[model samples]
Target chain A: MARVVVDVMPKPEILDPQGKAVLGALPRLGFSGVTDVRQGKRFELEIEGELTDDVVEQVRQMAETLLSNPVIEDFEVHVEEHSVAEVAASEGR
Target chain B: MARVVVDVMPKPEILDPQGKAVLGALPRLGFSGVTDVRQGKRFELEIEGELTDDVVEQVRQMAETLLSNPVIEDFEVHVEEHSVAEVAASEGR
Candidate 1:
């Protein structure tokens, strides 16, 4: 199956409390140099066939209508050659 | 400031109810061809300087220790040349 990725991130003006919490917690955990943080969502979709343009368009529409909130967020979509597990394994994790 | 991206995904064996909910909701929204769906997280970190190896290493460590639950999730890190807003603008959105 082909894998498609959709990333939904809050608008630049939107406040991300989750990311803020991480930013605050990081310095306490001995990590530094991170000036800001924004948390978002990622979706991986497994499809039955090749990544045809028609299929990609369908996914994009899905992302626009259901996967993201246009008023407060934006999303990007692309196809991946491997699944998340495959990528992790290839890195020798 | 340079940006770093961390993508944290649940282990393949773990049950992802969020993704399952999306999968069920898709067909109802008139989108199809998706056989499966997995939901994950994306974090964007804005740093003060260039993306040096030392800084990248720090972000990776942060991902491991705080951004994700190691027992249930796996994360990948990389440097992004632009923030999500820039990318969207370039796409003429």
Candidate 2:
């Protein structure tokens, strides 16, 4: 199986109450120093077989048409061998 | 400012209708080959200053306490200098 991850975020112009709530709760929980927080959506799709360019395109279409609200949100389609943390660690990002 | 991303996914046993809906809509939209879809949450936090290990720890705590529902979800905290798509592309993931 192939794993393709899609990350979706609200448009910058949009207001996100859920993010705001998290930001507000930080100090109360004794975790400070955060200036802002924006919440989004993540989708993991397990394709039945090998991941080809055509399948990637189809997944992108799926993200744009059904997974995210184009008017107020944006999304990214990622195909990786591992999870996000490992990627970050590998690149030291 | 430091930009860190947090990715949270529902536990495997959890039912995700939103994801299922996306899967169901794919073929109707003429985009097939997807076997399963799982949805989660992504958070982008803009810290006020540098991203130190301590700051990372605080952010992790924030994620664990407020950003994600631990009982039914799992999360990854990534300290990065760019967006998720850029990261994925940089690593060719």
Candidate 3:
């Protein structure tokens, strides 16, 4: 199976209140030197086939259509061919 | 600068309606082997100065407070150095 990871983020110019709130909270959490924080979204998909150009395209389209907000957000899609368990196992080694 | 990446995911027991919707739409987008899609969130922060344990802990707390829904989500945090521009340039090579 192919695994796909999608990351979506607000445009840099846009104000991200959530991110700002996190930034504001960092000092109280015991982090003194922290200056900024930005928040975004991630999606992981397991597809039942080999990783191919067509599959990548479809995944990208999927991100554009339903995974991201075109107005204020930007997105990126990454595809790989391994299950999460397999990935964890390989990393454990 | 230290770069912090936070990935937040729904607890396996929680229902991800948006993720389900994305999974349902994948087939129409032309990905055939796609079986499941789990959507989550990613937060990238550019912190000023060196990366230290305290900084990492602070970033994690920030994630918990503002970036994720505590009841339904689980999270992981990663810290690195280098600006986004530098990271992009290194990847371009």
| CA-lDDT, candidates in order | 0.89, 0.80, 0.71
List the candidate 2 regions with Cα displacement exceeding 4 Å. Answer: A83-93, B84-93
lDDT of 1 by residue, B13-81 (tens): 999999999999999998888999999999999999777888888888898899989889988887878
Pairs with steric clashes in candidate 1: none
Ranking by lDDT: 1, 2, 3
- Using DockQ as the measure, the top candidate is 1
Off by over 4 Å in 1: none
Please report the candidate that would top lDDT against the real structure: 1
In the range A1-93, model 1's lDDT, one tens digit per residue, is 789999999999999999899999988999878899999999999999888999999998998899999889988888778766677788887
**By TM-score: ranked, best first:** 1, 2, 3
Q: Compute the lDDT of residue B57 as modeled in candidate 3.
A: 74
Q: Write the per-residue lDDT of candidate 3 for residues B54-78, one digit (tens) a residue.
A: 7777777776776677777777776
lDDT of 2 by residue, B6-86 (tens): 888876777888788878878888876788888888999989887899988888788778887877777788776776545
* DockQ of each model vs. true complex: 0.80, 0.45, 0.43
Candidate 3 Cα misplacement greater than 4 A, ranges: A80-93, B28-31, B61-71, B80-93
TM-score of chain B of 2: 0.85
Clashes of 2: 0
What is the per-residue lDDT of model 2 for residues A1-93, given as tens digits with 9 covering 90 to 100? Answer: 989998888777789899998889888888878888889899898888888888888888887788888778777887867654344346453
